[model samples]
Target: MDFHLTPDEQAFRDEVRAFLDELLPPGRHPSDPEFLSTWQRRVREKRWVGFSWPREVGGGGGSIMQQVILKEEMAKRRAPALGTCFMGLAWVGPAIIEYGTEAQKQRFIPDILDGKVQWCTGYSEPGSGSDLASLQCRAVRDGDHYVVSGQKIWTSIAMWSQWMILLVRSDPAAQGKHDGITCLLVEMDSPGLTVRPIRNMSGTSIFAEVFLDDVRVPIEQRLGAEGEGWKVTVSALAHERSSIAEVEGLLRKLDELVELARASTKNGRPALDDDGIRRRIARFETRIAAMRMNGMRFLTKQLKGEPLGADTSINKLHRAALEIEMGDLALEIQGSDGALEKEIDGGRWQRFALSWPEVVIGGGTPNIQRNIIAERVLGLPKD
Candidate 1:
C-alpha cells in the first residue's frame, strides 16, 4: 500500500508548517501550567485545536490525514502539545460528536472550539483506574435530573475546567460489570461539586481529586443511551488512542532528545559521538519511525471509514514505550546531572525522569495495553 502523502496533502502540510512558524512561541519553555495556558490562547487565535473535526461543529472539517499532517508538523516545530483546551478538544469533543444529541452539540461544541469552555474527563474514580468498568460512582434519576454522588481521582486540569465528561453507574445490579453505566456532560460549577488539586512529584498540581456530593445533572446532559456507557467509553478510548496530539508530543520529545544528545558531552566528547549513545538514539529513531508509520496507517484506515478497533491498543503501547525510552536516553545523556532536583538548573533531566512514570500509567497502564493486545489482537482466552 502506498504510504506517501499526495501533492495536495504535501502543500497542506507546508501551509500548516508556515502557520505554526507564525503561531508557536520562539524560545523553549518547559511544559508547565502557565505555559500551557498561553499556548491554549494562541491555539484559539489560530484555530488549530480541532483541525480534524467537522466544520458544522466549529472545526476545520479536514480529513484525518490532514489532521495527522497538522500534528506531525506541529511536533516537528516543538510547538506546545498540551494546550489549555486539550481535554475538551482531544477527548470530550470527540465523545460529544459520537454520542451527544443535536442540542447538546449546538450548546457545547461552539464554546469548546471558541475556548470559552474547558472540559476535564471524569472516568477514573478513587476505586477505578485501569479497571474502569468497576467504577461505583452512582447517579440516580430524580425527576428531570440525576443526583450524582461519587469521587474521581487523577482528574487532569479540573481546577481550570468549566465542564466535565463523566462515566457513572446508573444501575447497580446489572449482570456484567460494564452494564448499567451512563456517561454525562456535567457543569463543573454545579452545586455540590468540588475540585481539589493533587500535586505530583514534579511539584505541579496538574491532576485533581474531584468530588460530587449529590451533584445534579439535567437528563438532557446524559450522553448516548442510559446503560450504554461501556459502549461510549470504548469509543472514547479509541479516540484517545487515535489522538494525534499525544503522538505528536511523543515525536517532539524524541526530537528534543536528539538535540540534547548533540549538545551534551560525555568522556570529553559530544554524547552523540559515543557509539553506545548513538546506537541507543538510532534504535529510538527506528522505533519512532515505526510509530509514525503505524499512526499513518491508522489515519489511512480512518480516512477509509474503517472502524478503529483493538489495533489501537498496539499504537498506545508502542507510543508509550517509545516515549519512556526517549526520556531514559535523555537522562542517560545528562548523566549525574539527571538526578538533580528541578530547582537545580531547572531540573531538566530530573523532571523528565520524574515524569516518566506517569507516561505509562496515565492514559492506561502498559500492562493494560498488553492485555488488550492479548485478548483482542491475539484472541487469547481471558483468565
Candidate 2:
C-alpha cells in the first residue's frame, strides 16, 4: 500500500489536527472530568465517536483512512477517549452495526455513541477457557421468550454495566459444537440475574462472575437468528483483537517507561544509563515501530474491503506478551520500591504488573491466539 495520502485524506487529517488544536490547546488539563465531558460531547457532535459506522445508524460514515487519522491526532494530543463506553465503543457497537436488527440498531447504537450506558460481554464461562464453542450456558425457548440459566466468569465491568451481549447454547445436541449457539442483548437488571465482583491481584474488581437463573429474555432482544452466534462472535473477537488505537496506547506507555527509567536508579546510577536497560528500551522502540507498520498493512487490507479474520491473532499474541514484559521491566527498574503500592510513580508499574489478566487474558489468552494463528493462518493441523 502507498504511504502517501490522497488530497482528500490530507484534508481530513488537517481537519482532525485543527479540531484537536481548538479543544486541546496549550496548558489544557487532559484529565479534568469537566474537560473530558466537554471533549466527548464535542467529538460526538462531530460524529467521531463511531466514525466508520454508517450515517443511518448515527455514525460519521468516515473513510477508513479518515478514522485512522482521527485516532492518530487524538493520541498525539493525549486527548480523552472518543466516548466513555469502553466495551460498547470497542466491539459491541461494531457487532451490532454488522448483525443487529433495525430495531436493535435504533435502540442501542445511538445510546452507545452517546455514552448513555455501559455494556459487558458474556462470552467466557467457568470451563470454556478460550474455546468459545465449548460454552455450556443454556437458553431454552418458551413462547416469546428464552429462559436462560447459566453462569459467566471473568465478565469485565459486569457490576456496573446496564446491558450485556451474551452467548447461550440454544441447541446443545447439535451435530457440531460451534452450531446451535445464540447471542442475546440482555438487560443487566433483569430478574434472576446476579453479579459478583471478583477482586484481582491489583486490588480492583473490574471483573466479576455473573449468574443467570431462569432469566427470561424476550425474543425481540435476540441479536441475530437463533443458532448463529459463532459467526457473530468471530466478528466481534476480530474487532476486539485488531485496534489501531492499541498501538497508540502502547506508544504512550513506552514514553512513560522511558521516563520511569530516567527517574530510577541501579548500581548507584540512573537506570536509564545502564547498558542492559538502554538495550531493552531500544528493542521496545523497534518492536513498537514494527507493530505500527503491521497496523498499516492491516489498514491497507481493510481499504480493499477485505474483512479482518484470524490474521489479527498475530498482533493479539504480540501485545499480550509485550505488555507483561513492559510491566515487569518497569517494576525491575524501581527495584525494591516496586513492592510498595504507594511508592515511586504512584505504584503504577506494580498495578500494571498485577493487572495482567485484563490485557493478557481478556479477549483471549496468548496460547489461544497462537492456536488460531497456527491452525487458521498457517494451515497447521490441530494438535
Best by TM-score: 2
Cα misplacement distance, residue 359 of candidate 2 (Å): 1.1
- Range of the 10 consecutive residues with the lowest summed lDDT in candidate 2: 236-245
Specify the poorest-scoring 10-residue window by lDDT in model 1: 338-347
- After TM-score superposition, what is the CA distance of residue 194 in candidate 1 from its true location, in Å? 1.6
Return the TM-score for each candidate structure: 0.88, 0.96
Where is model 1 more than 4 Å wrong at Cα? 21-48, 80-84, 241-248, 342-345
Q: Model 1: per-residue lDDT, tens digit, 1-383?
A: 88678999999988887767665657746366676676777666556667667777867777767767777677667676524467777778888888899998999887877778779889998889989999999999999999999999999889999999999999998999999999998999999999999989878788899999999999999999999998987777666635456666666676778788888899999998999998887887777677667777777777788876766777678777776777777777888877656533477766776676566688788898889889887899986
What global local distance difference test value does model 1 have? 0.80
TM-score of 1: 0.88
For each candidate in the order shown, give its overall lDDT on alpha carbons.
0.80, 0.88
CA-only RMSD, every prediction: 3.2, 1.5
What lDDT does candidate 2 reach at residue 318?
A: 69
lDDT of 1 at 187: 93
